[model samples]
Target: MISGLDDVIAAETMLSDVDGLNGRLVIAGHSLDDLAGRTSYEAMLALLLGEFLQADTAAITRNLAAARREVHAYVEGIDAAILALSPIEALRAMIARLPDGEDRDTAYRLLAAPAVFTPALLRMQQGLPVIAPSETLGHAADMLAMLLGTVPAEEQAKALDTYLVTVSDHGLNASTFAARVVASTRAGLTSAILAALSALKGPLHGGAPGPVLDMLDSVGTPERAEAVLAAELARGERLMGFGHRIYRVRDPRADALKAALQQLAKAGAVPAGRLALAEAVEGAALVLLRQKKPDRALETNVEFYTALLLEALGLPREAFTCVFAAGRVGGWIGHAREQIDHGRLIRPQSKYIGPLAA
Candidate 1:
């Protein structure tokens, strides 16, 4: 048996393809390069759900806006006690309160939960009242409005939309696999999504982006990048954004988000010097990684630019993964339904290496 199911084809999907060797990602019928900055998050969601659901971009935009308003009632119940947990934990706790189902309405509710809950949780923790979601605004725009209590600039909204689309799905990842396994058991979409969120909570999965920002904070400037990164590597600390388990070449999503970050910088949403420091750190990290581990392909991954993009868009680091869920929940729901339609009970075999009983 393969350890950790390395290179195992667990399931076939029409949703997204992750070509690790070439560092390419395709969602539904579109390449990541085509979809990221050009397509709206609502449109991406429509594409992902098109096979099983009939909603188009406009329909999705309207339904998702309504879903946000529906989920706000639950956000209103976040007490002082719930505010004590970390943002992801608080987000999880709130999501757990949503009912389970296998229908389209249920799917939309699951899709809207994180976007509605995350900003509210952040506000509550900061002793600020949670801003209600606007039904007229689009998904990314409304999420930004909720978080900031003001209308987001068009460029900022577009940047967040790009980020969401860039990460909407990858083929059979840890969390999406978790979602499918739970779905295989016929446990309903909410259970599947919660399982996925638990997997994403692990640092190896959805946790890296936050730490990339931390690394940037530590590096402080372009001149300090090499020294800081080299020191971290010398101490055997894995550089947060330098490598990915998949992708032998630089991740294409990294390029997608780097472009978005540059746009934000051009629009004056992010400082030019801050963007320069990030670029310097990325350049230095690549050089140091090559010099240190010549055998491995430790290239830039999505987390590097994801950190900068989200920070520039005004999301605190702690809420990064929550926002990730907002985008990925569409995929989770789509994959859950796909498994329900075409998959069976996912019971894999074990080698049973333990000693025999007497």
Candidate 2:
């Protein structure tokens, strides 16, 4: 038996392909290169959800924008203590509060949760008023506006869009699989999404980006990248952003986000020096990783540049995982619906080895 069920073929999907060997990702039949660089988060959401929900793009966009507003009323009614929970916990609570209806409108409402709940919780943590989502703004733009209490600049907004698109979906990741498992029980969309959020909160799944920023803070200068990485390597700690379980080569999403950061730098949205510092650290990490583990290729992965781009976008490190949930909820919903339509319960058998006394 494979430990942790490695190489287990649990389910077949069409939502996204994580081509780890080739370091590529395809979403809904489009290459990551093609989709992430140009697609709006709404467009991708419409595309992914349309297959299962039978809703047109216009309807999806309208319903999602409306849902963003609806979630605010939901957010407003929550107890302040509940809002004080950690980002993922707060998101799970707010989602549990949404009415349970297994339909397209509920799907839209579920998709809007992270976009609304994350920034609201962050603002509450800062003792600032929670900014409401603009029904007119796109998903990424409105999310940033709520976090910052103003309209995001065009370039900054576009960078956020790219980050969202890049992370929207990836095969049956742990979080997506959790969503599918819950949906297989014919649970409500909110229930399935809450399961996804729970899985995402685990450090192994959606928790590395914040620590990447921490590594940068500890390094403090471009010249120290090598020493810091070497020290960490010598201590036998796994580097936060360098390796991936699936990708044998570099992660394709990392390249897309790195490019987005470069674009923001070119547009004068992010400081080139910050981007350069990250690049220096990445270069040092890659070299050291290869040198130390010659048998394994622990190349740079998505969280490396995710931290950089989100930092440039001015997102708090604490909220990074929630922002990721904002992007990935679309994929979770799609997979959940697909699992439900396929009509199979996800009940896996376990090998019993605990001293049978028969």
Candidate 3:
């Protein structure tokens, strides 16, 4: 029996690798650290989709932006009555309306869906009208610009770019796995993305980062962090950002976001010493956690710094997961394409434990 299939090699891949034990990640031949502050989200997307998408960079960028514009129109047309729904629910509705297909145009559809869906979700949460996308700017810049109705600051743009690139792809996470399974059935690209988003909406997947802010609010200050954390631990609570299912050491993306947060803090874009305070809390909590658990390795993951960085960027907590979806749309599309190209119906058998009928 494979008994839990511990470390079972599922597929041969060229997408990305997650070395959990070593706390490293490589995407398409570049280490995450090398690419983090170095490449724009558009550049990183080109790298991930290059082997499969042969379109010219300018053409792809234009197509993607156009797609975003199209989806923005669709989102604006959604009834105001529906605006009262949860952000994720509203996003799901918008995505559900996307056209179905796998032709060259499908790439544009995938690109547009996230751009429209995420902003619409954010606006709905704020009880504001969703803004339509403008074709005049780059995709990442346009997203921030549309959401705020003004051109983003240079550092803000850079931070958003880093956030998007860092999260654009990860090898076969739960939502990506769901996407792959759907794509493996030769489903339409939109269907695959919808499935992926459904998975991502779940608490175990993309719903974590918002809670990190709550944790910070509860702790309130560096001096109070240890006492709050100690009490929370005593109550058998898990710290919001302290553990990941994959990385035993530390999430590579956390460091990247931490660096971005530090830069933003230095530029006086955020409160002074907030990052340092978070670090102190995290360090104290980790040390105390290790002493308590003794056997399990529960290190900080991407959500920790994700919350801090987005907070510094002045985004509300409710918008955190929507922001996540904005970046991950590319990876979802790429993986869906790869799964479709590979052509397998992802059917797996489960061990039967219930009694058989007579």
Candidate 4:
């Protein structure tokens, strides 16, 4: 048996492919390079959902916008106790209120839940009123508007959209696999999405992006980057954003987000010093990693630029993973449907190494 199911192929999908050796990703028929900055998140959702269902970009966009408005009501139930928990926890609690089903309607609402709940939870935690959703705006734009109580610039909205589209799907990742496992069991789309969210909450997955910001904060400036990273390496602490379980070279998503960050910087939306320092730290970390490890490809991954972009988008670091969920939920729902349509129950055998019975 393959430990941790490494290199195991469980299901066939037309969704997304991760090519680690070559550092490439394809979502549906589009290359990540083509999709990330060019395609809207709604359109990306349309592309993924089209694999298993019939929906156009405009219809999917309109439906998701309406669903966001519908899910906004669930935010009213986020009481003081819920606000006391972390943003992701609060988001999860609110999502549990959504009705569960495998229908297209349920998929839309599940896809929309995190976008609505995350902003409201954060606003309420900061003693601010929850901004209602806008039917006129697209998913990424409306999320930023609700979070900041102001319409974001076109560039900022596009950056968030790029992020959503970039991460919409990536083969059978931990969360996606978890989502598909529940889906294969005939669990509804909402149940599958909740399983994905639970998997994403683990630090090894979506929980990682927050700490990328923390690492930057600790480094403080570009000049101190080498010394700081060297110390971390010497202490045998893993540099948070610099390595990947796949991708022998740099993560392609990192380049996608770096381009977004650059575009945001060009628009004067991101602080130049912050961008410069992150670049410096990234350079330093790459050099140090090559010198120290020599055998491993500990290049910068998605988390590095993700931290900078999300912070520039005015997301509190604590809410990073929630936003990640807001993007990935579409893929989760689509994968759930795909499993329901064409897959069997996911059961793998274990090579028993425990005590033998007579």
Query: In model 3, where do residues sit more than 4 Å from their true spots?
Result: 1-6, 124-129
- Tens-digit lDDT string for candidate 4 (1-358): 6777788889899888899999999988788998889999989988899644477998888888889988887876778889899998888778888888888888888888888888888888899988999989989999999999998899999999999988899889999999999999997888888899999999999999989889999999999999998999999998989888889888999999999999999999989899888988999999999999999889999999999999999999999999999989988887888899989998977677999999
User: Which candidate number would show the highest lDDT if scored against the true structure?
Assistant: 1
Tell me which of candidates 1 and 2 scores higher on lDDT. 1
| Deviation of model 3 at 8, angstroms | 2.7
Each model's RMSD to truth, in Å?
0.9, 1.2, 1.8, 1.0
User: TM-scores for all candidates?
Assistant: 0.98, 0.97, 0.94, 0.98
Per-residue lDDT of 1-358 in model 1, one digit per residue for the tens? 7777888999999999988999999999789999989999899988889655688999888888898899999987888778998888888889889999898888888889998999999988988878999978889989999999999999999999999899899889999999999999999999999999999998999988999988988999999999999999999999888888889998999999999988888889998888889889999999999999999999999988988899998999988899889888989888999999999999988778889999
Model 2 lDDT tens row, 214-243: 998888889999999899999998888988
Ranking of predictions according to lDDT: 1, 4, 2, 3
The local lDDT score (0 to 100) that residue 296 gets in candidate 4 is 88
RMSD of 4: 1.0
Clashing residue pairs, backbone N/CA/C < 3 A, model 2:
none
TM-score of 4: 0.98
lDDT of 3: 0.81
